[model samples]
Target: MRLLSFVAVFLFSFSLAEVGFAEENGSSVSEERLTPEELDYLVNEVGNTQEESEDLPVEVSRRLIEEEAQVIDSGSGFMVIYDPEVTKPGQISTFASIAATTLKLGGTVYKVKSDRSKDDKFYIYGNFQWLKTPSYTLVDKMTIGFPSSSGLYLPTSGGKVKQHQHRYSQDQQGNGRWIDYTIKYSPSNWEPSAGVAGSYDIRASTSKTKHKGYIGQYVYVPTSKNGKINIKITYGHRRIAGTPSVSVYPAGLSITPTTATDTRSYALTLSY
Candidate 1:
């Protein structure tokens, strides 16, 4: 069988699925803060899987800067909670696998509902009702590549803590379902105490779900005319930002703009 290129409309199914995964076979339809009963209801029910599809690798899983930790299981797939602080909201998780191996074999994926208007609200989903695709159908086109990332920033030695402006572009297409691009910039962090200057550029992108994504990367290699010359260079950094705000390792540096400055040019500064 071939992979189903499109997914179906997810509606009432979420409620049944959520309850099936919830505690003690319970279903809470009202919108209210979880009481002790509800808390118990949720914690017990969330991320419950079907006892099948337990072995797919997580292609990309990005924990938001201000995201609540979630639980994952073969029956329920993936779940997302909430964070009280550091608020810049987006998806909770993103998961991808070979179409043939996952839903076809016995796995599911869950996406957070954007339109469902309730605080701490989410929905649980499942896939592959008729067993559309098989694992052995497409071995000839198989290739292995790990997702990666590259990042750049302002020169730490410039004493430029000022927030800068920048521009960006993206495109998500084909099976990849992501927007890819190249970025050039200075280091986001500066060590005044040691006077160690650093700068890096990043090329990154994401899919519609944005979690458990992949990045292709190449690092900056510094060139030296003479070993004695102390010149601040625009080299690349291997560590890339996991989200829109900061990188996986932020040493007082932020690559993304807190806000866009000029819409046309798409530029940024060190100090905002």
Candidate 2:
């Protein structure tokens, strides 16, 4: 994607070898605090996928990063913010993908909503649904992804997706209706620690009526180098039905701001 392109060009121009891969066995100590409930939730319902390294081939990683992290053309002197929010009752908000454009001054935080009618599921990040049945409790699936940087910080609110279901039973007025099945939520332990190239992968299953949900969030962290460097973000999510989820391995490229005292233009940095 755009971000991957940015990193590729930045890395190629500077001739910096791509960095090392994060170990599969949960290399980074997550600063995100897990609640007893969340701990039990993860341990009992979901397997710790981050601890097992998938060993994405070097060429595959490079190609996937470039193919998925598309760059946005925000023009010169513009800061492109690639952010997305997911919402629903009982589930954590997540950015299935991101949006980008020039940064607005005094508006460092950007907000965008999900539009199901537009097939804008990218904004939703992962697949979520609430199905009904006669004999069984409804089965709901939850997936979450985390970045590989400590500097990232996600706010408690913002991305929200509401859900509704139709019930055949009639109200006092004798009319069938759509019931609000919106799942209320709080943030989870989703933050990244410093200098880790690996992300968190979480998934869980619960009864549809259990009032349990997952919210995945993403926030950008700023980094700098003496010279030009490619800021490649390694993001991961849970694979569903053996099909690879896009958020499971999303990559992007970014350019760190240059200092005023560092008069060397980015082109010059390429030579050094």
Best by the TM-score measure:
2
Q: What TM-score does candidate 2 reach?
A: 0.22
The reply for model 2, stretches above 4 Å from the true place, is: 1-127, 130-141, 156-177, 188-218, 223-272
Q: What TM-score does candidate 1 get on C-alpha atoms?
A: 0.16
- Clash tally for model 1: 47
Q: Residue 232 in candidate 2 has what lDDT?
A: 28
Residue 270, model 2: Cα distance from true site in angstroms: 25
The CA-based lDDT of model 2 is what? Answer: 0.24
In candidate 1, stretches whose alpha carbon ends up further than 4 angstroms from where it belongs are 1-174, 192-272
The deviation in Å at residue 156 for candidate 2 is 5.7
Per-residue lDDT of candidate 1, residues 20-55 (tens digit): 555222121212222344334234443422232121
> All models: lDDT?
0.22, 0.24
Residue 8 displacement (Å), model 1: 50
